[model samples]
Target: MRALVTGAGRGIGRAVAEHLSGRGYRVALTARNEDELHKAAAACAGETLVVPADITSAVDQVFDRVEAAWGGVDVLVANAGAGSSAPVHRITDEDWSRMLELNLTAPFRCVRRAVPGMVAAGHGRIVVIASVAAKRGDPYVAAYTASKHGVLGLVRSAAAELAGAGVTVNAVCPGYVDTPMTDTTVAEVAAKTGRDPARVRATLAAKQPVGRLVSPAEVADAVWFCVGNGAVTGQGVDVSGGAVQS
Candidate 1:
């Protein structure tokens, strides 16, 4: 099987890439950072193709390389995204647009490019690494929340349209993940509030009923299930350590 994972340079995307490759999939990794992408590729136990590029603009190139070698991608994990934390009053138009473009539009563009070949072959899986923000509203980070909601919308619509095409469109909604992104957020919160970084991190983790941040590998397991199971389409699996029950 051939799989293409965006944002594979780090975090949940990197974990997913490694897991899939271990399961015998030929993985293609894409990320903005060339060095990180190479590292991710090296970590894959199976064959890997490192196609470093800004996913929002270079999605096609990533697909093209995968297609050239393996005919078509069996799985496309659209995990490249950015998060921003700002109150509505503080958000600029550029910030909102950037959030939407990176978190929502980019995945749609990748799906648009990958769907045709999947439809032709009668098998494919598209998994988006959305956030728990997709399901509920948050105080700050309005743009990030909106964009994630838009991602879930895209998944539902695409899944409905591809009902009988053997293509599953789904999302993994993680919350307070123990990744670099969350660590950055913790630092930002600590810096803004005059609280110790450890305290801030613990507070964020406490939001989950499990009293801890979800691991990147846990989110990757959800992605792997979505890619492998044909019956699980149009669904958003919450890997949020019981933070999101619905």
Candidate 2:
């Protein structure tokens, strides 16, 4: 099998890429960070192609490279995204546009590129790494939440359109994950609020019923399930540790 994972340089993307590689798939890894992409490729258990480019403009290059080497992509995990905390009133146009571009538009473009081949081949899986914010809104980070909501919208619409085409589109929604992104958030919260970073981290973790932050591997497992399960499509499978139930 052949799989392509975006934002594979680190966090949940890296975990999913590594997991899929372990399952015997030749993986194409993409991210903006060249060093990080190579590091992720090196950790993969199977064959890997490191394509370092901005995902927003690099989808065609990704497809070209993957097709050139492996025929076509059998699976695509559109895991590339970014988030920020800004009140709705304070969010600038640039912030809103960037979030939408990274979290919603880029994934849709990837799906558009991959669907034709999948439709012809009669088999394909696409997973978008969304967030619990997609389901439940929170204070601040309005742009992130809106972008994630748009992701689910895309997933559902695409799934409906491709119902009989042997291509499945789904999403994995994770909550307060223990990744570098969360670490940065923790640090920022601590620095601004005059609290210990460790305490801030704990507070974030405590929001989950599991009493801890979710792991990248857990989200990766959800992605694996989405790709491997043919019966599931247009579903937002939550890996939010009971933080989201709907």
Candidate 3:
């Protein structure tokens, strides 16, 4: 199978690209940073077409390149997201709009562009990278939480509409992970609480019954399940290390 993953320069996105590549799928890696995108491609075991474009930007060139390389994508993993720890009142309009564009709108656009050929071929998978905060009411991340919830809803709606076309749509909701984003969040928490960074991490971990941060590989595993696990659709699998259990 061939796959296209956004925000694939690092962290969970990079991990998914690598994992899918190792699984013998031809992968397309996309992000804004060309250097990091190439670095991610270098780690892949299978073929990767590097397309560096910011999904939030809605760049025409990005979609053009995808159509050129693969004509149609078998799997489209909309994993790009952006956020900050600002409280609702403290957040500017710019902040909220940017978050929505990156986290919610971009994925919708991706799904729209990718599904036509999927319908033609009679098989496809679309995985949205949501967050545990999508279910839990997170106080300081109002925009992010709202956007992720939107992603989950979109997944369900699309899955329903695409079921007859033999396409599965799902979202993976991951909690704290040892990624650059989590690093920034942990550091910010430490600075705010006047606690050590390790203590901040532990506090986040303690929120999960698993008592540890979720790994990128774990989240990737969940995405793969939706992609290949038989007869599954419209599911939002939680990869949050027992946080936000449903």
Best by lDDT: 2
Distance (Å) between predicted and true CA of 216, model 2? 0.6
lDDT of 1 by residue, 1-246 (tens): 999999999999999999999999999999999899999899999899988899878888888888888888989999999899988999999999999999999999999999999999999999999999999998998999999999999999999999799999999999998888998998899989999999999999899999999999999999988988889999999999898898
What's the count of clashing pairs in each model shown?
A: 0, 0, 0
- TM-score of structure candidate 3: 0.96
79-188 per-residue lDDT for model 2 (tens digits): 99988887799999999999999999999999999999999999999999999998988999899999999999999999999989999999999999989899999988
lDDT of model 2, residue 195: 99
Provide the lowest-lDDT 10-residue window in model 2. 81-90
| lDDT of the structure predicted as candidate 3 | 0.88
Clashing pairs in 2: none
* Residue range 1-246, candidate 3, lDDT tens digits: 889999999999999999999999999989999999999999999999999887877535666787788776898899988767887889899988988899999999998888888999999999999998778787899988888889889999999999999999999999998788888888888888899998899988888888998889888898889888648999888998887778
Which portions of model 2 miss their true places by more than 4 Å? none
